[model samples]
Target: MSTTSTEPARRAGWRTETFARLDERLDRVLGATAKEFEKLRVRTVGDLMLHVPRRYFSGTELSDLSQLRVGEEVAVLARVLRTDVHQGHGGRSARGGMNSRLTSVISDDHGRLELTFFGKPQVMDYWRRQLTPGARGIFAGKVGEFRGTRQLTHPDFVILGDHGEIVGGAKRNAVLAEVTRQPLIGLYPATAKLRTWTIAQSVGLALDQLAGLPDPLPAAVRRQARVIGLEQAYRAVHQPQSKDEIDGGRERLRFDEAFALQLTMARRRADAKAHGAIPRVRRDGGLLAAFDARLPFTLTAGQVEVSEQLMSELARPQPMQRLLQGEVGSGKTIVALRAMLAVVDAGGQAALLAPTEVLATQHYQTVLKLLGDLAGGGLLAGAGPSTDVVLLTGSMPVAQKRAVKLKAAAGEAGIVIGTHALLGEGVQFADLGLVVVDEQHRFGVEQRAALSAKAAAQPHVLVMTATPIPRSVAMTVFGDLEVSTLKEVPAGRADVGTVVVDAKNHPGWVERAWQRVIEEVGAGRQAYVVCARISSQPKRKSTDAYAEDLDTDPGGEDIEPAAAAVDVYAELSGGPLKDLRVDLLHGQLSSEEKDAAMSRFASGETDVLVATTVVEVGVDVPNASMMVILDADRFGISQLHQLRGRIGRGGHPGVCLLLTKTAAGTTARDRLDAVASTRDGFVLADVDLEQRREGDVLGASQSGGRSSLRLLRVLDDADLIAEAREIAEACVAADPELIDPGLSDIVTHVERQAAGDWLERT
Candidate 1:
């Protein structure tokens, strides 16, 4: 094709050209100060061009001054008729005169308006010079009435003519011409000193250099995807002449982002397939069969299906990169145990990584209880091969931790469970076959890779998460990993009833909430009173002793402190619920204290556990049927869902009362209402994604500074992502290594996106 020959040259030119050549520097192009330019962070012409507008403003609808409402914002082009400086009528100051302000009168053909600015003498003089008699310019601001006259207070004005040593009048006229020619005005994200006008001017200069830029996407692929050329996209996004052009440009950019991400995922999958892993296949299901026989309940069909999928992956010589997602009480723990048993049966060690020490201990205890007979030295002692399970945490006694580590190093521990302590040095495994990461989102990609690197042979990875992810988010965020969903809860589990209690609407809601907790406790059911903060401290007096004399202190001595877990625990134990057993738990407590508190709560000795979100995961108590979350508006949607999931695990129905000070018709109220309406985590996940921006979903540790995705929205651009994924699959299938010259830029972009991630070494 004719386009092929010139494309390389264009690409080379764009890569080599500097911002200086394109006149896009703040100082040279927009007359900005050095400090202001430092805040812009635009280095090259490419960077300037990529700084797209946050929103657009229309310049075509210029309103006449006579038609402007008192509170409405309007724009007008007018000629200055007079400028005057007048002193205020207030009492004389220590400098022997009151403050002064500069006032200017400007008029259009039909009406006139006054502009006022109050400031120091030098600043007022500067404005007085700019608004000299007969000066013409554009002014935009809110219209206000000042003593029967329509006026604009400190309006944003752009002088239309050339001043002493500045640019010529012709250049000013050209800027005005460009502004009038465009259908919309671009409002860019800017710093305090670098306004939108400065950014627009710099972008205008950069657009002129688009002719020599290369399209990151190949021509055939672009045509197939129906995306605009990269050069045209840059032009239209920065300087669009029509709405259609803007839409096309935005779509192309979104596609480019999504395609790049999918390409990276595709390459990762291919590379993972190329690597060799030790097949963890076990012919004898002796230990697994025995473990399942001891279970109190039967496995759900969804769990069985997912277990089969995991077994199949474990039998392969390639590493299994799978994500197991389910709602709370979805039997994910049992499924993970089954996978671990498979590896153990194959004469290999399996490691279970938990995000917190409490969770690690919980898993260790649950596994110990489940493996009652088959756990050597038990009732079913000689029924099957004995499997040794060891627990490692940061706070374990030194001698005990050393014993656990020795067992792990010698391959004596068939299944090792621990928190981040497992990632420390000297924590080696004899032969790690499978790694199950619980609460996968709590760990970073680097930590996952570190665990994988612990073994000589590649290990099968099964990442488990209780937070439900929407289908669209999973496709984009976890695109490289195969997913298995466990939607069905085990039989006999009761659904939880959630209600939102507005403290603002009901005057006695707080007392009623406490009474409800008391009722639940009196009925022989435990309660969890969750608080946002661990402790509440009294407000200290002002630091400046002279603040009161100067009348500068904003007093808050009369305001009561917010309720904390400790405060609430003390109150319930000594005051209202004095007869009941109450305990406090938080992250600040020592490991032994935490363990004690949890043990008491689990054993039904503590009637109420006032804790923070540390109890959000893995602290299952069947007797605790009621939970009251104070300041529920402060918690995120997914977090609220997870906290509520801690209840209703037993056969009895659970109740979750969400207490909020937020009023009706607020966003916080809406979020609480959504959570109260349905127990479906998938629905709430969609709402969560909608509320927040698509962040570093892969893991925030991998992304250095910039976000993984820029223009693509996982929720809104699902269709585009799907299409790009299809094309990316084909592209990677054709060129697994991405060696084609046409994909060189794309390859580089992906590498940059990966940063120092473990995949970079691969």
Candidate 2:
């Protein structure tokens, strides 16, 4: 009792005194430059200190300028070889009436680069004098090429003396000295509005004002983990003397991020255990058992094992927070269905939230077909003890939606499945015992919380994703939730063969791909034609699945837009596969139109379904054995894997053609080749993680905020994350309430930053 009483006083004292310096506003320290710093989101002294340099340049080392790629932002130190000023076009005023140009040639040890600036005569003369022959300085800008010559147009630069000292006026030297004084010059992430030297000066000012930094990690944990303290880390990261110091500082900070995250997760788990949960124990001869007995096929051993784990956890009086990830078509839906039925049998309701309307509707149909008479809920003749299944979507008619809400509120609907509409108004549940989220990554924390709020008590949550996550990602991102993996695909599932149709080198391959689709249709099988967009309109946004796959012209070169479903459907239905029946489906289409297209394809009434990635997940058609993806290079690796998973589910072997205009030996083509080479989702998952920033993997994109993890890499720091998790669990076991003020503050800060998504608060 005395310990509890002192905890509040200790926390208050720490907040008021220990962290006061960190909480100080940047304006107090940085004076006028604070406004510029604020543009980078460094509003506080602590934020400024934590803004570590992205990379460092060594005064003793020089990089090969020849290797620099176009479109890359670079900071290079070079000596000016020559300078010239040209007036207008070929020394005469042409277009725009102000075409004076200042050009200079700069070179390092390896290669030469050209610099150009276009302005009025005064501006050109000023630049010409600044970039005279023999001048050595650091030039930074986006690498551009003109007439096959590497160049930086109107780049940011700082001249340096022979002794590596910045050569400038008193005020200029003062700002850049904080950045150039060390043996290793740090290159920070700078923007067009704020240069690197100004940010360094701001950091220096903030650092000088910081009186002290309280370490969040306990001394013993630091010793065990072999990491430095917070103060040393800040100094080493921002003003390092050597690369080794940079390494040490980065590791320590990464551990801080991991430890804070793990502690939050552990505390959440403990709090969840402390709460009272209604037990959803499965009973004998219940809906689950009855359904299982009538199944024509046997469950895989992996499925059976995962099912038992879920059943055991659900039977307990603690809310179940489990993440079920498996290979595509590995039967995660079956396992989730069994758990939902267990909750229904325990006199409760279950809700399945899908990311897309198509998936929700497909799940509704799949459940009905699987249950047959067991879903009658006493409304049908010769039905046993059963319950009703309802599908609620935003596109549903008002009457239909109202009926679903009434059934859900009255506890008549044993299972509820819907899109985001289920989280909207007037959706109540009599006894919500479980929630099953499909493609869990697509939904954010607030949406989950809203559904949980509908329950009288915290409902058991089972999130299922078809995109197989690497173990390291599973630990780092979903640490608070228990993860169950299913790797085995059910027996009799046919093999899927992937082929890359390079349209750039082999233009005929495009026609051949269409021919293959026609042949599959001729064989009494349906096919899918996937596109990156709905239409070619410039203002229309890409579908959610292909949102990140939009074409980017970094080199300022003309490039064609990605293939669109509407255009492709028109072309195929009129030109290549004109004899076959084809229907278009995309996000822009009305719900009724989309549903009709899917229905036609599923029932074999449509020979080909041309659509965007709306069918990326959970749209199953056994007879659809072929898929041809147009401009497949635009899609991500995991997305490509998920898209192909639609085919190959039936007993017949499947064929997937990836048509791309990307040339060979390019990054885009390599990604497509990797997807075509193997079908292992786990392997592809690791590759995907390696290619993407850790922030995206941790749901920072969904939350629309900076990533909670600034220094930690979910891929490279796997072992560090594992060790931190172990130490955090031990710390939580010792102090379940996180009474230590410093540690508690760290957890709170991380949670606040990632409030909407990353941590998934209990």
Candidate 3:
């Protein structure tokens, strides 16, 4: 060959050499000193670290022979009493072409077992010569079932007679019962090479060759978390010596995960507090007094306590960053109104932001009613003839919007209520002092920063979430912000006694309930029929018929009105109830339509309004007493609680009917029963957590990417998580910056937690 032609092979050899050297460097990087295989080309050590299991075979023990089920790998020791070479059993020859031909029978005193050596007559010859017929040999092999009998197929056996200890052992029993397994053996799963012997072979090699990988967590982290190192963790996880070790490792991982999360939250809070520039205002109690005096009912102790704490925060110079948490109907709004009043009386503008326009309108109207009568000059009336409160919803008239915009910009709209639309670029505040955010958990940390940036000075913010967070979770998730809970309900409000009724019994319940509503309305009360599905949801194709898609709802305008689902709305409004002012209220309706429907409902124009859970939050129709659900089982207990909260605001003998359709399934019945048992939303939340896992709870993926977790479980280790979180706090308190040399490795670990792809390597 010419030199030019031979260059191609030379270059190929060079590339292979380069690859080998790179792999060597990677191995060094992964702390490997010696390369194991000289011929095989390997990937980077980092790549190898990510070689988790395709599956786990989970090892076993031979002692528990009775526990040996049909599908288990059992190891036994036996003597090879005899060996024989023959042609293949089923009329095939072993001494020929590449075929499954050679057969050998291995025998012990217990029995004779056949061993097949496919296409390898030399294998039999080697065994016969080495084993020496009638001399004892040790067999380390897999047990296979052949013709309803246990047999060893192509077993790996060694002659033990040559060994000095077993020189004359063939006279005794040929089989030895010294069988031992890892007890609960963990396997590296199988591949296409799936004979029971195949997986066993790979595992045997791996166990012999693989070294225990070290966990990098420092001693301080382990001591603080009351846990073990990474190697111990892996061992305990796979081949746990005892139940206690397994539990201990699990505790360590849980604590580590929770501690990481807590540190992140704490760091964010501390950084924000440190970097923020807040305007401290002197204490003002006069406005709160006036607002409370005009209120209709006495404040619950929880409300009073929260209100006092919030007022104290406002009174100080510190940025009033606090989370206002409580169950449904626990009077968080009243506390918000009082805090806003405090800012208003201080001659500072205030904004009350809500997640939905419906809630904004309701809150705006409540404030308007309070300020318009007898003290009409207290709040902005927008473009309307009065000057009591400014309602800046997307549905408001353009002129009204302009007036509210101008007044809020000029520091004249003392208290403004609106949706996230209020955070629009065009809106400017004269001096935003108090910003009350409803459904706080619904918003993220970045949104909080953007909203705070809108004011002249960073405003004191009071965040509210309707979810009744458990006390333990509250401590960590909202640890940065001061927490104020509203436990007790308002006085004179009747407890909405919940009852679960299955749909197997749901035929005439709606009609019967409607009749009761008619009587209550005839007696001057209103009724609400909450439909589950909205109209815009795509209809399931007939071919794609799946039972779970039956109640799938179609569409809604986020931050707007609830959309109409034709089925339920048509059943109630287009059917027998046509005579009443039965109107549809949904998020898909135009702004004007939503405003018209809400205004009519507020003005007693619509007697029975059919809608979705869009009315769940804060739409207060005092005269609306009866709440009827069409497909109650389709919704979570939290949603059910919110819907029930819409009614019972009027102080009448209110009744709620939860009508469930798919009542047959056990899960469906449990959901309905959970709703029917109590009105305590917090308790229901705990139950909700117990039922569903973490993925569905935080609802993270819908907002963006998947939630971060590898092997961590949220609910399974709640107690461990809580304890871990406390230890993390203490650790950080001891070393505020995590600059301690001992924790530097963990600091790198935490940084990599939010970074890309590092976890995937692990």
Best by TM-score: 2
Superposed on all Cα atoms, model 2 deviates from the true structure by an RMSD in Å of 4.6
Ranking by lDDT, best first?
A: 2, 1, 3
Give the C-alpha lDDT of model 2. Answer: 0.80
**Clashes per candidate (backbone, < 3 Å):** 0, 0, 14
Off by over 4 Å in 1: 1-50, 61-183, 191-193, 202-211, 377-384, 397-399, 537-563, 695-707, 741-748, 751-762
What are the clashing pairs of model 2? none
User: Residue 633 error for model 3, in Å?
Assistant: 1.6
Cα shift from native, residue 258, model 2 (Å): 1.1
How does model 3 score by TM-score? 0.66
Give the TM-score of each candidate: 0.79, 0.89, 0.66
Report lDDT per candidate. Answer: 0.74, 0.80, 0.58
Residue 709 in model 2: shift from native, Å? 2.4
What is candidate 1's TM-score against the reference? 0.79
- Over the stretch 732-761, how does candidate 1's per-residue lDDT look in tens digits? 898876666556456444544354443443
lDDT of 2 at 375: 91
Q: Give the distance in Å from residue 429's predicted Cα in candidate 1 to where it truly belongs.
A: 1.5
